[model samples]
Target chain A: MRNTWPGAGGSCLAESITRRSRLLAAVVGLGVLVVGGGCGRAPESTPEGGGKRLTIGVNFETLQTEYWVAGFEAIRSELKKRGIDVVDSIADGDSSRQLQQIRTFITRKVDGIIFVPKDARTCIPAIKAANEAGIPVVLFNRPAAETEGVRSVAIVADNRKLTRETVSFMVEQARQSGRKHKAMVVVGDLGDANAIGRRDGFYDAVKGNEEVVEVVSEVPSEWNQEKARSGVVNGLQAHPDISFIFTSSDFLFPAIVAALKSANKYHKVGTPGHVILGGFDGDATAYQMLEEGYLDATGVQDVYFEAEQSVQAVLDLLAGKEVPALILDPGFVIHQGNLHDLKDRMWGARVMGR
Target chain B: MAIGMRVDGWLPGWLKRGVLSDHLILWLSVAYVLGMAPWATGFVSVSNAQTILAYLLPVLVVSVGLTLVLIIGGIDLSVTSIIALASVLGAKVMSGEDGWMAGNALAVPVGVLVMLAVGLGLGAVNGFTVAVCRIPAFIATLTTMMFVSGFAIWVTLSRKIGGLPAGFVMLGQNLWVATVMAVAVTWLAHGFLSRTLYGRWFYAVGQNARAALVSGVPVGRVTFWTYVASGGFAGLSAILFTAGLETGNPEMARDNLLDVVGAVVIGGTSLYGGRGRVLGTVFGVLFLALVDNSLNLVGLTFYTITMVKGGVILGAALLDTARTRILARTG
Candidate 1:
């Protein structure tokens, strides 16, 4: 279902649009050359009178999600604060469009590029295009499929560590309640490296405790709410003895809650037979669920921090400063005790005004 | 006629007639479910049936419109975007404390109407472009699809719109009601396409638009109204989808265009346009849902599930081609 995950563009329509857009870009490029006498700079790049401004092209996978939109906004706003000229393009979840945009960025002769890839594997050509153009490319949140020929710095939250911490909290809660941890694991699209790493982290934590901590079902929901709900219903029917629930992303919280309620297994922290719910992607929804005592914990991936660091990385590259090839920002775990304090710190609260 | 008998020698006359041009998919769907019984758990159970039905409802509903447009020799790529637009509009009306219809009983009905109107408006645009403006169906609908999807994103600012009224949410969450609605809608579409003069015109236009015009069939009106119905149903589906998820997602059916087109084409509808039926689409959707459900039950990975779906669509298209040729040769 990764092929149909959140922000994945329409297949036929996107390919067709990309063909047309590429031709249009060529026409626009010719016009720019005629008007500016091959200035090799976007009109948005204004001279600040102090020094030459650095123009960075930011490519987003799809601006359809609050997370990506917020992250992009943070990056743009932060860069603007530092007087950096920004030009952005949205791929709408099509990797081909993303690759094409990279070429457009290269043609525009931007100083650097920031890419949020739809599929890590489909981004190699995009990274290569930037490298061939001698523009520094910064991979944000998602890594490129093949980094061998691509000279880029990847700034992503450590999803595996986040999931391990969240899953560990769920296990600890189950053990404290003296309940055998018969858990149902709802996974996101395995096509996403972050999702796979999170799932691996869950298994890593419960590795040798198979006797006490049992994984009754593993649902690959691909981060779809309806599919996740259906999976939960089917899983509950197949394994009614399940005592805990773990989700790879907090976006599945609604589906998990609905399914749990339907099965009459949803309850507060102290209630008997209550299904201890733990999730990843600490957003406003997860915090709300946590404050309500429905969700036990969530590992927060600091998307704002990821954006800030990505902007900084691209700037460093443009400045000819040494930066790490991979910058790992392992996020924190949030529970009831810290939910109140971290409510405003979440990405949703900051950008979405949730 | 000869091919039908050759394919199923032991079948009764009525079933043989069904197995050739139209009902071939229904029989195949039945056999598929029965065959997969051994490997998948609860394939024949009531709960499993409910799951399959619920999963197919939105696609089935939208396919009715697709079937109509396809019958008239046109395609609507904007249906998926229409669903998202309608869902967001409906959710917007009913969300928040000062929201238009937050807690009122009329909120649900009004929300439903607004969704339908939005869908109809978008559909009419596609119809106008294809029929009146004479743009290629592919380019026209594709443009609308991108525009509508982009507008929806702008309206919601790419955020999830939720807190819908409880009554409105029930349209999708209530399994029994949604099932009944799907069946009823399918029956109505079948009746409309078979019993009405407009239905005759649908086939006439699809068969040959110029010839249909010579015979005094208002090709433009028929094509326009067909798109209107398609968009209206997409709106209806938005209500169901939003209700089911209890949230308005701009990407609600971003990937469903293929599913709808596949079901329609698999149901024996010619992609080049003209001959097809809603009854066949009913089985087509069921066939797809069964494949997906059974594969999931058997613990097959998503990659494998996707391959199976693609293979099924290809086989169905081939069967459709074969049936058309056989009928042409026999006649």
Candidate 2:
């Protein structure tokens, strides 16, 4: 917001013009230097070696969360099984960064490109760019907007169905207990489609049961542990008698547990005065908690399977095979009872995340 | 003149003095908190106060060093990155991953040492770039900021590192301990700046580098060391922050640069430097914390809270400017 005077720093008008031009020249020079520094030689275009030895560029929305990290790890390991090499970069939730990386991948002429977009709309440009470069792009988890020349195959779990099943299970548990249900529904960022879908799913499940199951509090966490912790603390303080708490994801369970511990209200299943903990993103850590009876149920995204499927779709596309525009992989619910059976199927079950 | 003069029967000399200029903002904040007590639920409670203090501690610690840097006519934009870098390194050593210090009892002390050392070393880089290379402070520190931030991501691979020892974690959890540490550090800084000869060099150099050089003051050394000290404080803040969160996140202190700078400026520190106090920075920290806590207690919407906070800060700055003019006219 600070303005620079044209001739204040110089004595004469001509001198000022010269100074300004020099400054502009220096800035352009710096820009060129930076771009020049970033350049690398792209490997020569080679024929696909029986579809075995191919290089794939993978762009992640972010590796800030363990879920994404584990998902990427699964995709890499699965692709490695087929002797495929992955070159991955984290966008850190920046759309421009994601776009830039995709452009870099296109420049490098990687055999195939995989994108996990931070925002669906902002990913359109990147997808279009990849398409122009004749690179088959696969959208993992978050799909981009519909656009011409951007026919990217989308691989995502059914978020709405996932939450619906998880909440339906919670509703049944509340009914079996015969207690008036008081629930605190912790939503993630509304800007995120999954968060919106999950919130809608929970509300849809509880539509006709207002008398039996009351929504006491609804907090927006933006998928942050600290904010979620604060929300839980405030919610519990406001409604101490609430019977259940539903988090948008299992990633936030640590924050929920911390808040519960501070309030002296953390309890296991079957314990008197227990505040039932339910979450989405059926991570292995959450599964372990379910086995320990600390958690009740969660919606399982099965990130590993999703990863495996996404890589397969990219491979198929590379091999001139046709793939659907919208490949649906509906997730399921894992409660305390079935957690053991389903835990092994989860990528989260194998890797412990923060 | 009377030893203790008063304009009004109830208003003492000290009270009158405290209600002017820098101290005016502090008193206003206290009054604001108390005035909102009746309307805001639990705003005046001990538990709420501790929660507020816990959040305020790290920023306050960092502000002490920043205040010094500002007083010497320099700003370290890399303070936040230094925090991230120090925290990630500390967490890596203490994580007990791959037997590198391995969550042992000594790990806590070792982690603390690593954080401080890394902070100092990085700060020295900033100092060297500015003092030795003769680069402008802003551009020099900005360059360091980028590298340090990238280094942090490289260290942690952008992943959040947890598994800290319980003993170290306890330091961040106990509000009393954090509060005491913050106050002690602030008090020491205040004493050094006000009472020590070397500390006086900061003001002399900031006010006029050429004059200070003529007076045999090593202006470059003073400038360099201030940045190093700022880096050290940033490191200390990182430790406190990580201990509190029980995790090392590259994004933890990303938004704190504004808060630290704001605290120093609001504490009556001039942008051109040469005039400020650690005590004023302490007041500034408390004032902002009070405003934030009060706004939250009243359950204001996030956008409304942000607008109100901005307005309040602007109002304070305006009042200070008006007061200066009034004093000049009267004198």
Q: Give the TM-score of candidate 2.
A: 0.51
Give the alpha carbon lDDT tens digit for every residue of B32-86 in model 1: 7658766664444433443454457877899888999899999999999999899
Predict model 2's lDDT versus the native: 0.74
| DockQ-derived CAPRI band for the predicted complex in model 1 | incorrect
lDDT of 2 at A238: 96
Model 2 over residues A18-123: C-alpha lDDT tens digits? 4455424432332222122223221233235554378787878777676787878778788889788676666556443455456556544578988788655456
DockQ of candidate 2 is 0.02
Q: What is the per-candidate TM-score for chain B?
A: 0.92, 0.92
Per-candidate TM-score, chain A: 0.84, 0.85
- Score every model by TM-score: 0.51, 0.51
